[model samples]
Target: MSLEVTVVQACLRSGRGGSRTAVVEDGDLSDAARRTVPGAVGASQAVFIAAQDPAAVRLRFFTSTGELPACGHGTVAALAVLAQRSGNDRYDGVLHSTTRSLPGHAIGNAGHYSAAFEPGPIDLRAATIEEADPILSALRVSAEVAGCHVASVGRPRLLVELADRQTLANLAPDMPTLQAVTDRLDLLGCYVYVTPSSDGHTVARMFAPSIGVPEDIANANSTACAAAHLSTRGHSKLQVDMGDSLGQPATMTATVTGSPGTPIVEVGGTATISGRHHLD
Candidate 1:
């Protein structure tokens, strides 16, 4: 069987360099990720699309290892392709994944688009100080942590706050140990961030080896979780700088509304269309 695929780099900084994603229109193919992802497109994640209704489209994300409950950058890439196919600068649709339903809206034309989505009902919990020891050990860093917490938007991520941006940028995680800790805690990955700057920009990094992503260029799912966690501490709008540790530099924009307990968050940024291909 053959299928058409479009690859886009989402959450780019200065309209260049971001996470590479492959978007495939929904068809009869099963186990699509194992078939095309990382091989045909050389993507970190793959999105399978199916029309749910007249107003929305169902999205499924997969890595080289397995399917994910939801994916932020993948969603943006999928929506960008969908809107371009429909020839509409502004499009509205629902992103239906196995465990979530998100409302997605996108703007701009082909090869360049901006996407935003509302990830509903996130669970935030504080990770005990004892839990921090394992993460610090896994990263091979000193015990100079500021705080630690866990956030679950669509996937679970352990959020670790370091002493400062310098410390955050100087991380070198032991992949084997990180994978072990992720397995023990049943987490999707760990999101490490610094304290918010005066301009409300937070520099962060994401490391997820258990799910087959060693380090994400720009993570939208966990960043929203981070934003929700920040909302509790009296910050609403946040601009996150990620991927610097990898030299692929990406940016993420997040805004949280309403109260801390009941908050609505949107993670969005511009994306560039890299290329497209087909699989057989």
Candidate 2:
């Protein structure tokens, strides 16, 4: 048996840099075969479209190590592929994953594509001092932090705020300890960021060694979490800049509407098809 995989760069910064994702449209793979796609293609994550309908699409996400409940950038990559294949400039419908469903849409024309989705249920709360200590220590910084909180939009991620971009740039986390701390706290990863700049652009980085991705070039869900965290303090719309640390600089936008505590979060970014491959 053979499968076709489309590689896409999602959440591109100026149509140039983004995270590499593998998208498989075929739904005939066994669970065992599906798990091998990410590793085979050297992609951090893979999205499988199990079913597609006029009104809804069912998707499954996987990393080399295990299945993921949800994946933001992967979702974007999948939708962009769908939009391009359909020969439509815009595509909109519900997106169903194993854990939940949400409305999503994609738009494309002339070789450019972008997608967005609402990840249901947003949660944010300050981390207890005890919890913050280990995380900060693992990150190897102190006193330069402005705030720290645990935020989630489906999966929990620790949101750490630094005082300036230099601190963010100089981050050299203890990967082993950070992985241990995230595992202990039941966190997907830690998202450390500096506040928005004069132009409302938030620069950030995501680390999740526990999941085999020591550093993520682009993390849409974490950006959504950052939006939710900042919404509570009055900033509702902003763009997050990530991946520069890895030299694959990517960008994603998060918009928080409705209200502060109960805000609705939507994340969007553009993607481009980089290549394709056949696997057996």
Candidate 3:
């Protein structure tokens, strides 16, 4: 069998600092393209690629494992790339990502271009008691896993609210269990969130070490929607402090205004394009 993939290596230096993504797709791509594409960079490296058939720009996440729904940093990178690729149109409105969220789809907003992604609802029910212990062990979180919930930001992730910031910061989870939880619950991974009085709203840090991420994530757009829902319900805005504690800290902001269903979930930050590479 002959296999081919077209990959685009996109760079984004924004809220989360910087990430190099190599997007790959088969069917009309050169051999060189597949060699340097995102996931091909390393084992399990996360790459954001667009699956276009009818010329429809639908974004898909190509992790070391398979395709994922939504990816915040990748989407941001993609938005900027899409704007440049479209050549004519500017994605000013909320353009949808390929992934599905609980509410509908994940939405990304760029001044020149934006994306909308339909993610599953913010569901705490999908998380099971059987999976908690294994997940906590995977993250190396030794704290008491009391408040555990599941949310479908863009891709489904297990949200575990720790006792406090101190506990949240110090974690060294077991990888097998981490992978096990997602395999069992069939979630994206786990995002450890907490409420630090200094911030007022709940502060969360996400990690999918099992799926390929090793440290704190800079900005999670998908998580922003879930936080928005939680914020609206809790009457508090979600102040997501991601990628910090691990040192390179970044923040994502989402407000709780407008109607419940079609409510607008906006995440704000600066995205800088350090560089771009052509695949073969």
Candidate 4:
């Protein structure tokens, strides 16, 4: 298949885009970086990257299975392009992105080199023991999880609040077993969160062994907002740190009044562009 790609050189600042705006389309996105990064198509295929800004980004990888809801790295790359195109303070309004605009669930903002797109604020609600079992096994998260809930915005993330930052950072799941479990259960992926004893920001890691993407996502925009959306009901200001684990170490900040169920959830952060390229 011929691969269609749009490359942009850009920067990202903060506070931009709503929840369903901004998009980029790549005719062919390979799964090379899957698992190592938070988001992206798992196999070689056509991909659509859409964002809501400073908060959530969703990716629909048209696959044999169906349209995959979210992709992390692809979101980062798209924001890089948006940021490069519009530099400076917040950028709003309906603008043409690298890909064609998607109606309903698409809107966003731009910054120096950073862009944040929101999705329907992350909502953490209920889940059954059977639904939660696979995740526990996948992350090798043998112990029990507190404040566990079914979370989603762009992509479905099983939010598991660990005991401490130690457990959050030290996620050692059996990839083979976890993947088998999630696939059978029909889940997109799993993300674990933890609040530090004393904080600057929130720390989290995602494992989607089922879809074949492993641990480590630099900074998944959608997942970042999802985590914040879950915390706002009880806390204020969520700072997310996902460094080398996902390839690019970055920070995402979310401030709002509710978690997932709130009427509104806004997320913002700095996005830095590595560079640009013209696909061959």
Against the reference, the lDDT scores of all candidates come to: 0.83, 0.86, 0.51, 0.49
Model 1 weakest 10-residue run by lDDT: 30-39
* Colliding residue pairs in candidate 1: none
* Steric collisions counted per model: 0, 0, 33, 39
Pairs of residues clashing in candidate 2:
none
Better of 2 and 4 by TM-score: 2
Candidate 3, which segments miss by more than 4 Å at Cα?
1-18, 22-36, 39-56, 84-90, 93-96, 99-121, 124-126, 144-146, 196-203, 219-222, 225-229, 232-236, 245-247, 258-264
lDDT of 4: 0.49
Off by over 4 Å in 2: none
Candidate 4: segments with Cα more than 4 A from true spot:
1-67, 86-90, 94-112, 121-123, 196-200, 219-229, 258-261
lDDT of 2: 0.86
Candidate 1 vs candidate 4: which has greater lDDT? 1
Give the range where candidate 2 is weakest over 10 consecutive residues by summed lDDT.
Answer: 49-58
The digit string of per-residue lDDT tens for model 1 on 189-243 reads 9999987876669888999999888898989988898889888778888998898
How would the candidate models be sorted by TM-score, starting from the highest? 2, 1, 3, 4
